[model samples]
Target: MTSETQERRPLFKPVRGVTLAGLIGALAFACGVALTATSGWLIVRASERPVVLTLLTAIVAVRAFGIGRPVFRYVERLVSHNAALADLTDRRTAAYRQLVPLTPARLGTKRRADLLSGVVRDLDDEVDIQVRVVVPLITTVGAALVAVVTTFVVHPPAGFVVLGSVVAAALVGWIDLALERRGQAASLAARGQVDRVAHLVASGANELGAIRATDEPMTWLAYAQKNVEKAAFAQSRGRAVGVALALAVTGVATLAMAWVLDGEVEAGTINGPFAALLLLTPLALGDVVGLIPDALGSLARSSAARDRLEALLTQEPAVRDSGSEAAPNETVPHLRVRDLTASWTGEKTDLGPVTLDVAPGEHIAVTGPNGCGKSTLLAVLARHLDPTGGTYAWGERDVRDLPLDAVRDGIAFVDDDPHLFAGSLRANLLLARPDADDTDVLRALERAGLGPWLAELGEGLDTHLGEYLVSAGRSGAESVATATERSISGGERARLGIARALLSERPVILLDEPVAHLDGPTADAVVRDLLTASAGRTVVMVSHHPIAFDALDRVIDLPAVTS
Candidate 1:
């Protein structure tokens, strides 16, 4: 578990603001029930030819209740939404912080895009409960109780009927919740599988076609889609049954109330106008319950989302964030290791059971055949994963005793696939160093062999990239077209990644097959520029390509087994 979640807040923690919103919601629902009852009485009494002045009060009451319903409802919505959004902001921040430490290694096989999407979507569902579930459920129950007591006062038997109907509806709601809970879990699981398969097939279409391997992923995608459809249909069927039962209970209760009222009138114990008012009250309350199938489903969905979040947030991170203090501040600190061993999973070692040392400003390459742990060694050096056995140090300071981010901040680790966003050149480069100016950006680009590319651009730093939304002004937005569609190639993208690393201005650079995707000539050029741009910095390049070893750097090759 992360430090952010150590003092975790409950999904619906007790708060005065939420309580106030609930009370407002209840009041609004009561106003709706009262309006229907009064209007019924007014109409019935008018038909009976009462004294005109006596009718004046009933006419005025109907007007007040009618206006109050909408007005109170608006206030209720305002209060509930305000409180919910405030809590949502806080919860989103906390949940994201908890997720950061467990990323990559602990996140399984999912891409960062998939992980981020799930987190954002789940958090939204969890927060929506305050407005969608709690407000409506509380409002319906509170207003129904008020109707029950008022009916019992006017006609005792009718009151008992109202209470029984309400109890039955509440039971239906409970059953619906239980069924929906199961249905929602299944639907989410199925939908997640479908998305995963669809993404895999869509993203790897070219590779699959090239290798004639499309059949299996395509078949799996179809199966996952069918499962989603089945899950969705089952969930909808359960909801339909629940709604039908709740409405049936209301219909039965309305008839029982009528039967009792008819007998009361035959005995001359109650009047027609009074009976109309009492009958209308239950129908109005029943309408509230009738409107709640959507709310019930939302409650179930939110519960499922909360469970997913809890599962993720409570997971222990793969690496320990140790020490009360960060690493002592240093640029180009000497790196040393003694019999290091590490693993992606806890059960087996994937890298090391080896040793290495590097002086400040030394350039070194870790090269090996496939399965020799070249990438795994870089993971340990970048502080992404910790050594499971033996020791590593930075300038005599044991790295295990240093905070992860503090040690990581001193190194610029660039991987094979460097993500570029859809924005202007300036906006994209600004990500590496937010405070960097246009000159710093240009210099970085020039250093990474992008000077000629920049000069070729008509707009230079203002050149827009792939599709994205750009703010037009304070009031609106516009879409930017794809700039990379015109002249950008794979080599340019690789060089851009190198430029970003140079812009980071860290004392050490770690490259993990940065040119793995480029062609022979392009890869050689990129490696040359990289070695030139990182002349002074301590550089470690992990590659099996001989072109990567062109410069003055000792190559350390790892055998299949290190002892």
Candidate 2:
């Protein structure tokens, strides 16, 4: 997902195999209709005492149609499915490209499950439309055209009946689209209601319990469920109405074809055997038209999904991508900031308008009250964001002149919550530097004050650490309960973050309240260890504990913004 190479593609663009799939699907349906008509004609002709030899061609035609129908249908499915899946891969990659600029700063909580889920589900639904609606609709239209044309050549009046049936079916499809569009609003409202209640209950459970309103959420939940039911029922009704109206149109067309064939046969204008063929062709065409209503319903759903996706992906990145590929020359560059200001929302001042500077290997601490932009400053320093105002120079060149990726290569950030992926201890460190080996990992662990902790586990680099690990007291805590999947107390966890940062060996390290959740003693210990381990490395740490300020080279206290 963090990959910078972007081959962004249009979300709703047609995939390559769609046309070929449509043609194959059309031929498959056409074969079925032809088989039905030819069989009907053959049965009628046989009833007139025709010789077996006379029926040979009709028999062979029926056999060919039967086999061809499934064959073409199979081929169509193969092509359409492969194309759709391939497109999904490309679209997912593009979606990630769009999301790269929004990470950390723009998408709060670091990993936004809701936003990610919405993107995945909506993109999938959009891609599904190509298979479920577009290809099938094309097949239906093509098959109907073939049926109508052949029937018309046999008898113009019969041809008109088939065409009329198709038009009526199309009208039913229009009705389906209207109903679907109307229901979408209700469905969205219901979903929103459900989400609101669910979030309120999940995040405010303790508050609700204190207020003795635990049952209130149940009431809201029921109400939300009711709305969901209503929306679902409305959608079902649209499908029912479409199918019923389609069948009614089919019946009318069948009767009209029968009447026209009767007139032609009576006037000696059509043979009795051939009249059966024309009559049944229109009736067989009902299958083709019958599905249009549902296809349109699918189209409506895809359109809604596409609109949402467009709204999300179309947002301008909060940061300007310099797109510079130039590599940084200095191992530890001098940092200089002049009247620098940045905003997360791009609408309000989130950080700075203050001047700051630090020579290589000089450590600094930024202390400020909440909303004074401590974390925002870290984000800007990490090049995750663009400053709305001011200039920050690294190595005497404006940081903006450096490629984001190139500049980021020299920076490491360890925040309050450092995510530990579900993997081995070695794998977690490798995320910072994939090329780092066992010796490098061990060296980094030693530097971050995790060497004693690692030795205690006995698993060495193979020791597994998953989503969350409660860190025991300090390094080499006696008999800290160890598990194959998760082990390590809060202090150990904090040091692991430091180890990763050290592993990357970035020139500058930014700590965003790294011990915000740890107890005072543990937090102070972790902070002291980080500063000691960070010798000769430029470090900017955001902290509230004054104990931490004593060891820093300088402290910048940010004032609260006035309303």
Candidate 3:
């Protein structure tokens, strides 16, 4: 890796707020240990019929430690969680900015939904390391040190026992780290595969069942699940060993401390009450030391997550903006592709050596069989993918020389699957043109043939959509409103997508099989409305259906490539 690349890699620096939280947590653990030891000493001393005044100080101290432990823990949780959440928000924004240039191309062959889900999961895991792994590790180490030093001050031999037990626990933690590291990669891969399969099966259930291919995806899901289980089982062995070793070491240390105290008390080297406190110290300290092994496992998982995120974000963009080019100026942009060929991966050409020219306000359709690169051609034209060979020009200037945002702002792309967020009808429409008023949205809707539907709505633009309408129980006016929102058909969805594109006011519009999922009649009507609505713009659509071929000014038919 180049020095610049190395410098660009994300590093998790310790947050001051989190460090403070960890310190508080360490103090809390220490307080708990002191409370246990002090309480034991108080009880044993009281058994000898000591005066009430003599027990007063130890009683007050025990009560204070007991109360401080929970209070400090609560404060630690609040500070650490807030710091982690704030860090998560900043990292998510930066990571998304890095991912924008890599969309639909460098994000790999996995389903886009799966890839995006992985990014969210990995980012969450990475951020959680601060709270789950880092803070706990710091707190454990700090508390253990305090326990060792305090016990050593009371009884030198007992202090050494506590130190030896801690060293043994550290060795166990090291072993846990090695075991987790061995399975981390495999575990991550299995998780990704399971996520991919689960997303595919859920999102495409209807389509797969329609084609009777449900069994195939289910088989793949089962295989992925088995691998995930296997990895989990293998990783669990390390945790099990750590837990067993912790218990055994604590038992041995407690016994050793008790035996040494017995001899000290018998020889009059220490008071009977003080011996009780010294004997219970190791048991209290064991609680803090036991956390280290579990924290190590969290460290391993977070490390894996960070590595995956870095691997994805470090890739070079498929299309780089020259950064020194001027915007192209054309009232109605004209496009020319001469012998253009492109690839998702540079190793194989998926699109054309074929050529075409699009004049201003021209309506053209590119039709081809599946895998014949119609969508690939549209992707290249939309500047989402870069051409490996040939020249693509906009208004007589090479597109590669134009600023990326300039080119993108002049063109609008509507894909086969357009997302509808859960919001009011007005809110959904305004996403296309945020500054547009209700009148502008209605005009766009009418232009795309939703005039009749809009007129029939009782709430007009205020009608609620998405999950609320689907799940809510309704009566009277609510029932009517629910019916109105739920009445949107496949044809209306296509028109809504076109309406959004129209609101962009871009001179060139690219549609990639927008009506592919509709029935024949609905698809034909949608295509007709789209062509009518976008009459003044240059519309280049890719489709295999012959619904609106007669309406298009020209049609380009792509032939299949044979090796």
Candidate 4:
């Protein structure tokens, strides 16, 4: 097991479908196979007319036994597949929601793509073990036990042989497990490399053009290719070990069957049906034993993935929720911070021992030099990051005492680099309020100066965008068009983000350089419109331009905040 796997939270309950299917499958298999074995005994004792009737009865029972085999297989597949997908969905949603409270600024030194990959892909892969490995393992072992016990009751020597072969096969399987575990660790490392390489390739695509002018693209490709090789090498080694173990077990079973037949013949106790039973017994045991190593390999990976995902799900956010609610009046203070201090890591303080207050209808501009913790201050006030020390209150209640939903509903924030999901202009705008009507969406879009841009596009509000465009690539020209259609100019993207914030219409709005890419005149117009739009709300903004601060009710200079 991986070190991270130990961190996984235990599943609250076994998956219902997998558990139920496993139970039914194990019982059905035991009964069906045991009855078939009994038929073998009857065929050996009976002859002529009795033998023919007995054979026919056994064939009918066997046919019934196999009747729902496909159905059973389908049930197993459906149960296992859904469990992984459901768990992945839960983890992805939780991770993104956790990110809402932490904020991008609070991520400190972590890479965005690496974290994204872990939360999205990594967690999903991990939870699959619950259905795939755990349930199947339980059923297989249970079925094996039933088979062994039945054999023992019929013939003690056959039972002894089966038990001994099982023990020997298990020992070989354990050895395979040891080899597979090492391979699994290597596999995980290889996957991490792949993730990192993909991230670099994405972020450095433009830079890669310049680098390729100096023939450096090959170097980057080589590094990525090497990671792929490492992954393949590890996987091959694991599968090879499993295959070797299976072959060895099958060889041992074959030898045991040969010995059994020789001994029965010498004792003159061999009957046609009895001989057939001996031959079938060893082969059936071998088939079951062979499945062990393959299942073990999958289990190891799934176990590792499950543990990592669980750890993330169980983690408490660094920020605490506040039970405060927004009251409409401008007289009551909407937010107040007293000597609040915070740090991404506890060892080094990033902001304050500073005090601030903003009442409803107040507009505050926070100005500072780069890296002076201006954004961090706004994040804390917005309750995206909790104060490590001191108290922050909204209205009369402490911020931490406020309900998380209440705090979020009362506040809307627009970052300089706003994330736009893959969708049409109307679809993206409506994300702020899914049920918003066309009028509501167009109003927000026009306010952010996006209506003209949307209208200019032939597809208008229905234009498809984002990573999904890759699917529409039918030719080189189509691929180029797809990329261009989805691509947003920096200024346009900024306005799109602001449009979303405007649609929210929260009591408190926190904007981090909303006019980041606009020229002098356009920047002034945006600030003026923003101030006008936020007439009866609390606004906190980080800005450097003096003109941007004109309508602010308060200006908090970061130089005044001390560690």
- Among these predictions, the greatest lDDT belongs to 3
Per-candidate Cα lDDT values, in order, are 0.81, 0.82, 0.84, 0.68
Deviating ranges (above 4 Å) for candidate 2: 1-13, 47-49, 105-111, 206-213, 217-222, 262-273, 323-327, 420-425, 445-496, 519-525, 544-554
lDDT of 3 by residue, 393-418 (tens): 99989999989889988888888766
Q: Alpha-carbon error at 120 in model 3, in Å?
A: 1.9
Clashes of each: 0, 6, 0, 10
Q: Backbone clash tally for model 3?
A: 0
Ranking by TM-score: 1, 3, 2, 4
Of candidates 4 and 2, the better by lDDT: 2
Q: How high a TM-score does candidate 2 get?
A: 0.85
Candidate 1 Cα outliers beyond 4 Å, as residue runs: 1-5, 14-16, 211-213, 465-488, 561-563
Q: Give the winner by lDDT: 2 or 3.
A: 3
Off by over 4 Å in 3: 1-12, 110-113, 181-186, 195-224, 235-237, 455-458, 467-489, 561-563
Q: Is candidate 1 or candidate 4 better by lDDT?
A: 1
The lDDT ranking, best first, is 3, 2, 1, 4
